[model samples]
Target: MTVEITGIILMFLITVLFAYPLGKYFSKVFKGEKTVTDFMNPVERFFFRVCGIHPDESMNWKQFLKALLTINLLWLVYAFFLLIFQDKLPLNPDGNPGQTPDLAFNTAISFLVNCDLQHYSGESGVTYLTQLFVITFLMFVSAATGITALIAVLNGLREKTTQNLGNFWNIFTKTITRILLPLCIVGAILLVFSGTPSSFDGKDSLTTLQGDNVQVSRGPAAGMIAIKHIGTNGGGWFGANSAHPLENPTYLTNMLEMIMQMIIPLALIFTLGFYLNRRKLARVIFGIMTIGMLCLVIPTIISEIGGNPAIEKMGVSQLTGAMEGKEVRFGPAASGYWSTVTTIISTGSVNSMHDSSMPVSGVMQMLGMMINAFYGGCGVGLLNYLIYIIIAVFISGLMVGRTPEFMGHKVEAREVKIATLVTLLSAFLIKGFTALAAYMVAHHPETGWAVQPANWLNNPSYHGFSEMLYEYTSANANNGSGFEGLGDNNIFWNVTTGFVLLLARFIPIIGPVAIIGLMASKKFIPESPGTLRTDSWTFGVVTLAVIIVINALSFFPALALGPIAEYFSLK
Candidate 1:
C-alpha cells in the first residue's frame, strides 16, 4: 500500500515537474516567439504555402470556425471511405477487412473529433494503411484542432479589443510541426527501445511454455501509441489497450504512458498563464483543477486498494487487491490512479478493465468524465472549465450586486446562453441516451433491434445500468474509455454514439471560442473595487463550488441510478 501510494505521488510530481517547462515551451511556440523548434518553421511555412494559406493573414472568430469545420468535414469524408474500403488499400499485411458503414461512421467521427472511441478492435478490424494514414493522422490533427481552438481563445483574451483572433491554419500547422510531431518522434523512439514493436511484419507464431503454439499479432504500434498518449487520444493498437503486454510491456513503459497522457493538458493550463501574462489566474485555475482531480483520485485509490468487502465476506483472500481485470505489473492502486487520470484528462486508454473495478472506484471514474474539466484532453480542459468560470463570474457578480464581467468583457445573455447550452448538452445526451437504452431493454427487449439492450449488457441489474450510463458518459465527455461490459459494436450504439460524439465534441469547443471572441470584441473595462477579480483564491474557491454544485444538480440523479446505486447495492 505504501509503495502504491508512493508511486502515485511520484507520477504526479514528475508530471508537474515536466509540465511546467513544457508549458513555457508551448507558450513560446504558439506565441510565435523563437524557441528550440524554430528550425521547423521552414517546414511549417512550406505546408502553409502549399495549402494556399498566408501565415500573416489572421481571421475573425467566424472565419476561423468555418475553416475548422470545413476541414474536419473533409477529413471525415476521407476517413469514412478509407475505413469502408480498407481491404482495397495498401499496408494490410494481415489482410484485415473493412469496417461496416455504421462502425465506419462512428469511427471516422470519433477520431476526427479527437474522441478516439474504438467500437472496433484495432488488430482484427482496421488495416495498417488506415491505422497510419487515417487513425494516426487524425490523432495528430484532431489534437492540434483542440489546441488551435484554445490558441484562438488566448488570442481573444490577450487583446484588449480586437476583431481578429488569429489564423487557424497557421496555428494548426505550428501545433503539428512545432509541438505534436517532435514529442511523438521522441516518444516513439523511447517506446521502441522499451520493447514495443514498431515493425509492419505480420503475426509471429510462438511456442508457449505449455508447448502450445500461438499467433501473436504485431504491427506499427509505437508511432500510434506515442501520439495516442501525448495527444490524449487513447484508442489502443489492441483491444486490451495499455493492459496488453505488447502495448504496455513493463512498469517503465506504463509510467511513461501515464506521464505522457497528462503532460500536455497540464502544460496547456500553464501555457495560458505564460501567454496571457496572468500567472496568478493560471495558478488559481490550476489549483482548482488539481483539487477536483485529487478529490476523485484519493477516494478511487482507497477503494481499489481496500478491495471489495463482498469478496472478503466470501472468505476469499484479496490481499493483492482486486486483481481480476488488471495487469499484475500495474496493481490495483496504479490501475486505480490511471483510471482517475485517464478519465479526468479525456484520455480513455485503460491499463485495466474499468468494468471489473470496485463500485466506488467506478463512481470516481464516472465522476471524472461527468465533470470533464479537470485537465481535460489537450486544449479542451481549459476550454470546458471556461464555461464554469463564466457561470461563476456571473453568480459572484449577482451576489455582490455588480455587473458581471470577466477579464474586461461583460457576461451578458448571449455568452451565458451559449455557455449554458454547451454545459447542459453533455448531461442531456448522457442521461437521455441511457434512459432510452434502459427503456428499450425493459419495454422492448424482443423487437429484433440491431442492439437489444438485454443482449448488449454483460452484467445484469445495477452494474448493467452502469454500463449503459458509462458508454454515453464516455461519448458525451469525448473520453473514449468504456465499462467494457457493454456490447456496443452494433448499429444502434454506433449511430447513436456517433451523433453524441459530434455534438459533444464540437459544441463545447465552438461555444467557448465564440464566447471568447464575443468578449474580445467588447470594449475593455478598467478594473474597479466593485469588480470581482477572477485570479483571486476566493474566486478559485467559488469556481470550484460552482462546478461541484452544477455537476451535482445536473448529474446526481443519473448517477444515483448507475454507479451510486451500484455502490449502495454492493454495500
Candidate 2:
C-alpha cells in the first residue's frame, strides 16, 4: 500500500515536471508566434498563392466552423465504407467477414467518431491493409479534431481584432501536417524499435504448447500504436489489448506508450495557457486534472498492492501482485499506471485485464472515466475543462457577492447552460445504457440462454450484475476497455452499446466547441474585484467536487452492485 502511494506521488511529480516544458512548446505551435513561423511563412504564402487565396485575409467563425463540419462528415463516410467491406478487402488472416449488421454500424461509427471500439481482435478479423487504413485515418481525424478545435480557439482570440481565414487554415494544416503527423511517425518508429511488429503479411503458423498448429495473428501493429498514443485512440491491433507481447513488446515501448498517451493532453494545457496569455489559468486546469488523476491512481495502486487476503490464503503469492489478466513484463506498477492513464484520457487501451483488477482498483478506474475523461484528447480535454472553469469562476463570483469572470470573459447564462450540458451528457449516457444492460442480464437468464458454469452468470448475484454494469459503462463512456467477463457480442450489446459510443464521443466534442464558438463571439470582459481568480486552490476543490457529484448521481447504484459488492463480500 505504501509503495503504491509512493508511486502515485512520483507519477504526479513526474507528470508536472515533464508536462510544463512540453506545454511551453505547444503554446508556440498554437500561437503561430514561434521562430518556426518564419520558416513556415514562405511556404504558407506559396500555398495561398497556389490556391489563389490571399495571405492577408482572416477566416470568419462561419468558415472555420464549416471546414470542421465538412471534414468530419467526409471522414465518417470513408471510414464507414472501409469498415463495411473489410472482408472483401485484404489482410484478414482469420478469414472473418462483417457478419453482424449492428457490429458493422458500431465499428464504423466508433472509428468515425474517434472512439475505436473493438469487439474482435484486429489481427484476426482485419487485414494488414485494413489495419493500416484504420490506424492512419483515425490518427488524421483524431489529431485533426484536436488541432482544428485549438485553431478555432486561437482564431477566436484573434477574432477580437482580426479573423485571418487564410491564417486559420494555414495554422490548422501546419499543426496537422508538420507537428502531429511527424511526431506520430517518430513515435511509431520508436515503437517498432522497441519490438512492436509492423508488417503486412498474413498470419504465420506457430507450434502451440499442446503440439497443435496455431495461426499467429499479425498486422501493421507498430504503425497503429504510434498514432494510437499520439491521438489518444486506445484501440489495439490485437484483441488482447496492449497486454500481448507483440502489441506492447518491451519496457521501453511501455514507457513510450505512457508518454505518448499523455504528452498531447498535458502539452495542450500549456498551449491553452500560452494562447490565453495566462499561464496561471492553464496551471489551474492542469493542476485540477493532475489531482483527479492522483485521487484515482493512488487508491488503485493501494488496491493492487494490498491484495485480497482470501486469494492469498489459497497460496496465491501477493508478492507477485495481482497477476490475473496482467502482463508479467508490465507487472503491477506499470499495468496499474496504464489502466489509470487509459481510463483518465478516454484512450481505453489496456495493458492488463481491467475486469480481473482488485475490486477497489476497478472502481477507481471507473471513477476516473466518469469524471475527468471529459478533457480526454489533446484539444478536447482542456476545452472541456475551460467550460467548467468558466462556470466555477462564475459561481465563485456569487459566493463572494461579486461578478465572476474567466480570462476577462464573463460567464453568461448561455456558457453556463452549455457547460452543464456537456458535463452531464457523459453521465447520462453511462447511466442510461447501464440501466438498459442490467435489464438485459436480468431478463436474459429468464429467457433460458444456456449459462456456462464458469461464466459470470454462474454467481447469479452482485457479481453477475457487476459484469453487466461494467460493460454498459465501458461502452457508453467510449472507454473501450472492458470488464471482459460479459458476453457482450450479442445483439443487445451490438445495438444499444453502439448508440452509447456515438453519443459519448460526438456530443462532448460538438457541445464544448459550440461554447468555444460562442465564447469567441463575446468581447473579453475586464476583471474587477468581483471576478474570481480561478488559479487558487478553492476553485480547484470546487472543480473536483462538480465532477464527483456528476459521477455519483449517474453511476452510484450500478457501482454499488459491482465493486461495492465485491469489496464487502471479500471477507
Candidate 3:
C-alpha cells in the first residue's frame, strides 16, 4: 500500500519537475527566442518555402482557422483514400486488406482530429505504409495543430492591441521541427533500446512449451509507440495498447510511457505563464487543474487498491487488489493512476482495460473526461480552461457589479456566447448521442441496422448503459479511450462518432481562438480596483467552482443513469 501510494506521488512530482523546464524551453521555441533547436530553423524555412508559405506573414483569427480547417480537410481525404486501398499500397508485408468505407471515414477523421478513437485494431486493420504515412503523420500534425492554435491564442493574449496572430503554416512547421520531432526521436531511441521492436519483419512462428504453434505479430512499433504517447495521440500499434507485452515490455517502459503521455500537456500550462509573462496567473491555473486532477486520482487509487467489495464478500482474498482488467506488470496502483492521468490529459492510452475496473473508478474516468480541461491534451488544455475562465470572469464581474474583464480585455456578449456554446456543445453531443443509443436499444432492438442496440453491448443492465455513455463521452471529449465492452465498429457508430469527433474537436479549438482574437482587437483597459485579479487564489477558487457547477449541471443526470447508478447498485 505504501509503495503504491509512493509511486503515484512520485509520478506527479517527476511530471511537474520535468514540465517546468520544458515549459520555459517551449516558450523560447515558440517566441522565436534563442534555444537548442535553432539549427532546425533552416529545415523549417525549407518546408515553408516549398509550401509557398510566408513565414513573416501573420493572420487574424479567421484566416488562421481557414488554413487550419483546409489543411485538415485535405489530410482527411488523403488518409481516407489510403485506408480504403491499403492492401494495394506499398509496405503491406502482412497483406492486410483495405478498410470498409464507413470505418475508413471514421478512422481518417479520428486520427486527423487527434482523437485517435480507433474502432479497428492496428495489427490486422492497417498496412505498414498507412501506419507510417497516415497514422504517424497525422499524429505529428494534429498535435501540432492544437499547439499552433494555443500559440495563436497566446499571441492574442500577449499583445495589447494586435489583430494579427502569427502565421499558421509557420507555427505548424516550427512546432513539428522544433518541438515534437526532437522529443519523439529521443524517446523512440530509448524505446528501441528498451527492447520494443523497430523492424518490418512479419510474424515469427514459435513452438510453445505444450508444442502448439503460434504466430506472433511484429512491426516497427518502437517509434510509433513513442510518438503515440508523446503526442498524446493514443492509437496503439496493437489493440491492447500498452497492456501488450510487445508494446510495453517492462515496468521501466510503463513509467516512461505514462510520463510521455502527460509531459507536453503539463508543460503547456507553464508555457502559458512563461509566454504571457503571467507567472502568478499560470500558477493559479496550474494549481486549480492539479487540485481537480488529484481530486479524481486519489479516490480512483483508493477504490482500485481496495479491490472489489462483492468479490470480498464471497470469501475471496483480494490482497493484490483489483487485478481483473489490469496488467499484472503495472499492478493496480499504476493502472489506477494511469487511468486518471490518461483521461485527465485526454491522452486515452491505457495500460489496463478500463472496462474491467470498479464502478467508482469508471466514475472517476468519466468525470475526468466530463470536465475535460485539467491539464488536457497538448495546447487544447489551456484553451479549454480559457472557456471556464471567461465564464468565471463574467460571473465574478456580475457579483461585483462591474464590467467583466480578463487580462485587461473586456469580456463582451460575443465572447461569452462563443464560450458558452463551446461548453454546452460537449454536453449536447455526449448526452444526446447516449440518449439516442439508449432509445434505440429499448425501442428498436430489431431494426436490422449494422449496429442493433441489443447487439451493441457485451454487458447488460447498468453496466451496459455505462458502455454506451462511455463511448459518446470518449468521442465528445476527443479522449479516444473506450469502455471496450461496446461493439462500436459498425456503420452507425462509425458515422455518428465521425461527426461528433469533428464538431467536438474543431469547435472547442475555434471558440477559444476566436474569443482571444476578438479580445485582442479590443482596446486595452487599464486595471482598476474594481477589476478582478485573475492571478489571485480567490479567482482560482471561483474558476474551480464554475467548472464544477457547469459540469455537474450538464452531466449529472446522464452520469446518474450510468456510472453513478452502477456505483450505488454495487454498494
Model 2, 1-571: lDDT tens digits are 4554465456546655776776677667655566543565677667778877654456665666666667677766676677678788876666767535666666666666555667666765555656777656766676667656765765565445343423445666666655677678888888888877777666789889989987877767787887777777788888887888998987667777777878778877777677667677667776778778877876777677666667888986688577778877777877787888788887788999887888888788777666654446666666566666666766676778876655555567887887788777777777777766566555553544343223434235666676666666666656677776676555566677778877766666666556656666667776666557677777888877766766788778768878888888886
Regions more than 4 Å wrong, model 2: 1-18, 35-63, 91-94, 157-171, 208-211, 373-375, 444-460
Please give the CA lDDT of all the candidate structures.
Answer: 0.92, 0.69, 0.91
Question: Would you list the clashing residue pairs of candidate 3?
Answer: none
lDDT of 2: 0.69
**What does candidate 1's lDDT look like per residue over 367-468, in tens digits?**
999899999999998899999999998889899998899988899989999988988898899999999989988888887877666799999988999999
For the record, the alpha-carbon RMSD of candidate 2 to the native fold, in angstroms, is 3.5
Q: What is the lDDT of candidate 3?
A: 0.91
Clashes of each: 0, 9, 0
Candidate 3, residue 496: Cα displacement in angstroms equals: 0.7
TM-score of each: 0.99, 0.89, 0.99
Location of the lowest summed lDDT over 10 successive residues in candidate 3? 3-12
- Candidate 3 structure quality by residue, lDDT tens digits, 1-571: 8987787778778888999999999999888899988888788778888888899798999999999999999999999999999999889888899999999999999998888899999879998899899999999999999999999999999988999999998889888888898889988998899889999997788999999999888899988898898888888998898888889888888888988889999899889999999999999999999999989998898899999888888898898898987888888999999998999888888889999888889989999998999999889888899999999999998999889999999999999999999999999999999889889998998988866767999888888999989988888888899998789999989999999999999999999999999999999998888778999999999999999999999998888888788888878
Using lDDT as the measure, the top candidate is 1
